[model samples]
Target: MQNLENGFIIKQVDFKDNDKILTIFTKKGKLSVIAKGAKSGKRANLLDLANYIEFQTIKSKGLDIITTISMRNSFHLSKDKSSLYIFYPLEVISKIDRVDQDESQLFDLLNFTLSNLYKNQDLYISLFNIKTLLYEGLLSDFTNCFVCLKPLEVDIQNISSMMGISHFGCDLREYNVRGYPISIDTVKLLRYIKDLDLKAPHLGFDIKETVLKEILLFSTNLLESSFDIKLLSKNYIL
Candidate 1:
């Protein structure tokens, strides 16, 4: 049946030159779509990742195909690193979010997150934490233990060799195999990211690079183990 759905583009890849596959986190489906002829201007450039818009689609028993897409005003203001990091969630989305499923809440969260991401690149990690929490259905604030739910106060002691950070009493390694520490900085960052109004610009922090690495590593471990996806981003980073 022909249908309409609203969504944000998660990932887009060229198919046969003009055809494109768009993994859209839609109000109804978190999976990707084969938007035939999208790259050739057959559709407005909703193929752009994070482009928020409505789509005309055809639903099959198996998969839904996007028939047409229209540009919405919300997508035009973003630029730079903000644009890139917003797509990073796909590293997680591609793994967990299912296609052809009703997921309007996920869609709204994605839209709001992207809006924030476009305005605040420095807060990308925090935003990433939010997406991760949404996927896991857990709270994103790192202030509490991923375990005991007790407020923590570590000064960065225990860390994973892969990205060990022993500050905030979180130590779940290898897809959260259970033995590692998360730094206070990670927790603090999460707390700040989840609650701070993006409308308010971040005042900046004094956390060291090592602490940042711990958060990244911890999140990476969780996401990779949970989703079985490789973040080639580490390989490509210059």
Candidate 2:
């Protein structure tokens, strides 16, 4: 039987001669499918990374086999370094273990991000990072310290690269983790972004270069440290 799944191609690798293996992030979750003899054909183009595609696959004892596929959205964006930033979030999504109930939101986020990443690059990138933390139940409350459980009035000092928000002089090392010294403004920005609906317009998202860098850095740190995986797109984005 052939099952139809729509997803974004996150990674692709050469299998044997003329075959390609794709790791697609579908609404069901992450799936690996082999495209037999797809190395040089229309199927090859359809399997390109970051392309949104609907494909049919047959289950097997090993990897699923892609029987037929079609492109849904090519994104038509440049494959340059900066534009390839989607890989940062895609890589994270590909690695993390998300529940089935969360798949709908995750799939929608990737779809939206790919649609708007070209024009709203920074906003979507930051949104992806902050929202992923929220979906994964990792983002800490911005109003209080995750460590001391005390009310954090405007003096927040560090944001955990993986787990918590903290006040000044808190001992994050005691938890065997590291964090970046963050500003109240950045904290407010993150909290604000997190609360925004996925479909809401980000009309007021113009951010200072320094603060934007902080958000990116903290997000990168969070993904890397928490998952124990290095994001290939990290160097390009930062």
Best by lDDT: 2
TM-scores of the models, in the given order? 0.65, 0.88
Question: Candidate 2's residue-wise lDDT over 7-64, tens digit each?
Answer: 8998888999998889998777888889898888666777778889888888888898
Tens digit of per-residue lDDT, candidate 1, span 1-238: 4666676776777777677777776666666677777766646455666677777878766457777678774554345444556556555566664656667555555566566655444345446645556455654345444444444454335433222222223444223554555555666665665565545646365766665665555655655655556775433211
State each model's CA lDDT, in order.
0.57, 0.75
TM-score of 1: 0.65
In model 2, the Cα lDDT at residue 189 comes to: 79
RMSD of each: 5.1, 2.6
Identify the leading candidate in terms of TM-score.
Answer: 2
Lowest lDDT 10-residue stretch of candidate 2:
154-163
Instruction: For residue 127, give model 2's deviation from the true position in Å.
Output: 1.2
| Steric clash pairs (candidate 2) | 161-222
